[model samples]
Target chain A: MTTPGLTQVLLAGILVVIAIAVARYWRLPVIKDMAFGSVRGFVQLVAVGYAVRFIFDIESPWLIMLALGIMMTVGAHAASGRVKSVKGSFGTCLAAILTGSLITLATMLVFKIISFDARYIIPLAGMIIGNSMNASALVIDRLASDLRANRLAIETALALGKSWREASQKFHRDAARTGMVAMLNFLKTVGIVALPGAMTGMILAGADPVEAVLLQVIVAYMLLSATTITSVVAVELTIRRFFTRHHQLRIDR
Target chain B: MAVTGSILELCNLTRRVGDGTPARAIVDNFSYSFGFGRLYSIIGPSGAGKSSLLRLLNRLDECTDGSVKFKGSDTREFAPCELRQRLGYLFQTPHLFDRTVRDNIVDAQPHLSESKISRLIQQVQLPSGIVDAPVDNLSVGERQRVALARLLATQPEVALLDEPTAALDPANTEAIERLISSVVTDHGVTVVMVSHSRQQVVRLGGEAILMVDGQLIEHGDAVGLVKNPGTPQGRRYMNGEPQ
Candidate 1:
């Protein structure tokens, strides 16, 4: 039985305090969900840590790809639930999440900065997939909210013989616009404002300055690709499902 | 009299929706016709398919077993947007757009003459000042009127309203009832409205369509239905007695 280090234990404690303070300050209704989500995240990371240790040493490239597949699937699932309320566009979440993860993951692997092993593969996959999940969810949630908010305009468009896609175009655009903000910020502030965990870890492991910078650049660029793909795909696919064959909204009449 | 119509028509219509529990197959083997320049009030319980039948005209929900023919053409035959442009439907609780009232109406039919739009706003009896107001700033009555104005802007040959006054005060209710009459008579738009209130049915001055458990029990002559309802459900509805 391997015991966690003192720093690891302290970090967990600090995370709990941070979560509690944030929830209280934001007036979050579900403190329990926040706590459970945080705890579950930490537990998952720990399990992945050991699993990556074994996989990285196994000398099997397929397992590396398998980890990426798993990451994309989970991200897609998260995106689906987040955008389920969006009419017609729920199916779009899968495409967005998977596409986003693939573009980001592919670019990183091709660049050879992180190396094609589970140690880097799993962690990096986790980060890109996690970001894709959030971005796709935001796209779906924002589209649904905007559609409901602009129900009159949409209905009027439908009444005017506009296809469902045409009616919901504004909503899709607005949602995509709002969802991309986070990814855009990450793109703008990648080097000067913050050092992502992966590059920092490599630096601490005695990697050269050029290598760390190269790795960071690849990660930043890939994340941008993934999030952009997600935002676009989710909105387009979801908007398609929102209307009937006659170009009317498939809402309760 | 069984009304003959080219405004809105339901021919051999039967509707089934969902899959048990969440599934509802309330309307079955029913046919009705609505004519131009006539106002129709449909009164029934929650699952009576009053709303479902109205939706058939807009193709929002389909009839499982029969065809809904509008103006002698199958609803499926018309392009949804094209058909809907000439057919307006309003929800019980109006879902107002988050924009100014002018945009809400004019944006739907951008090419419509400005004079017709001003006439529609005036016809709905909405104040001139409310036309530029944001949808969120308006009261429930105001929202419903704006929604109605938007619908009318499409120049619909038929107007389908699902309990348009469900969320309004009595003053607003009377205003909407008056608006319904004004539209049907003036614009020659056929009206099909769902109402749970018998008073609204009486006040709106239309053929009373008494529906119960998704079947039409009584149709035609609102005064006659109230005076001597042929079906038990119709009598119960008129008497305000539990069915």
Candidate 2:
């Protein structure tokens, strides 16, 4: 269920108007891209809402499971291409995104923190899936840029017959840290400085305020955990692709 | 004929592209070595693994599985950067970064000053005006010089150039030849060039390694191979006979 409160609508409208104004004033090249993105977001969200309603009516667990698997695969591929650092390494990425998000979703639903329904499952998955994609992309891109810039140091380590992990050890930690920072910031401001959409929706729908607070706490924790796991998995797999068993980068011609 | 050692041995080093699904070896089973202070050129037909072989020296392509030793050390053991530092590479087509021509030359060592830059730029015979100009604005030959200057800047012990004179005008080609001759004479850089021109290799005068179907078929003194290539590989390729 999409939230339809006055505050939410007003905030969104203001964001759009501000975005246009900023683009115009700064002569930004991405004004069209921004507008196009917003329009696509609206259409996709609307379509997903309708699609979830139909799935909820079917009440088939297998179908729900299939839906989740498809979401993870598509999300992983999109995220892979989105950043040069990760460079489309999908096998590990798909596993990470799916396992992390689904496990978190399952635990929350069984605990009654979030009700077990398609409406909740689909939306929670969307939120977790979107953020996981972003964090993984950041992690992969950071690793790539780091690798590209310091290839000399990496090769020096390799020439000494060091393994891929040993060669890129310095970069691995930094790239993971950068990706984790966003999740950390989200955790810090979960309640005090901001009211998240899921929590606000529950509160507006007249659930007991305490229950809503507890539910939102679970959501925040799940998002943080899922994003962290996905980011780490993305970085490690991406770095391994940078070399081969013979300790060489298979450069594309 | 002066055939060099199996310093770097390749039993069946092949590199096949197009997903190399089964990992086919296009630059197949190439066995050769870096003889001390000796120059060599890997000449072959189009689609041959000439460039791929050059890249293999630096492990730019991990598909090269066989051994490429250097000074009794297994090439596989040396780090890619270390291998590359000892061997300079000039791409078939010249390309510079999105900065000034001088910056492209200084890419290998960014801390170079105006005086050092001018000397190298002059050595490559680039006009002084080309330094400040945008790299993208230069002709292909000018870009080649910049790439050559950058290679020299790295102070590599071996220079591997893929079609170094392919895109040049006659004048530019002659200047590049002179630059290569001087670099070899003064810098003592072991040069391995991939050239189709018999005339150019004759001008440069060194050893020759001929490849076909990813295999090294003939390698000997350049003068000897060009005059009377004993192997079927040398005679057929030089005669331009239909395969």
Number of the predicted model whose lDDT against the real structure is largest: 1
The per-model DockQ list reads: 0.36, 0.09
For every candidate in turn, the CA RMSD to the true structure comes to 5.8, 9.9
Docking quality tier of model 1? acceptable
Q: Interface Cα RMSD for all candidates? A: 2.8, 7.2
Q: What's the TM-score of chain B for every model shown?
A: 0.92, 0.88
Candidate 2 backbone collisions, by pair: A159-B78, A159-B79, B13-B29, B14-B25, B14-B28, B15-B25, B15-B26, B16-B26, B20-B23
Give, for candidate 2 chain A, the lowest lDDT window spanning 10 residues: A153-162
- Give the TM-scores of the predictions, in the order they appear: 0.77, 0.61
Off by over 4 Å in 1: A1-67, A74-94, A104-126, A137-162, A170-181, A185-193, A207-214, A238-253, B1-5, B21-23
The collision pairs in model 1 are A88-A241, A88-A242, A89-A238, A161-B81, A246-B80
Candidate 2, residues B105-221, lDDT tens digits: the string is 665666788888888889899887778899878888888898888777777777878889998999999999888888878877778889988877777788888888777888888
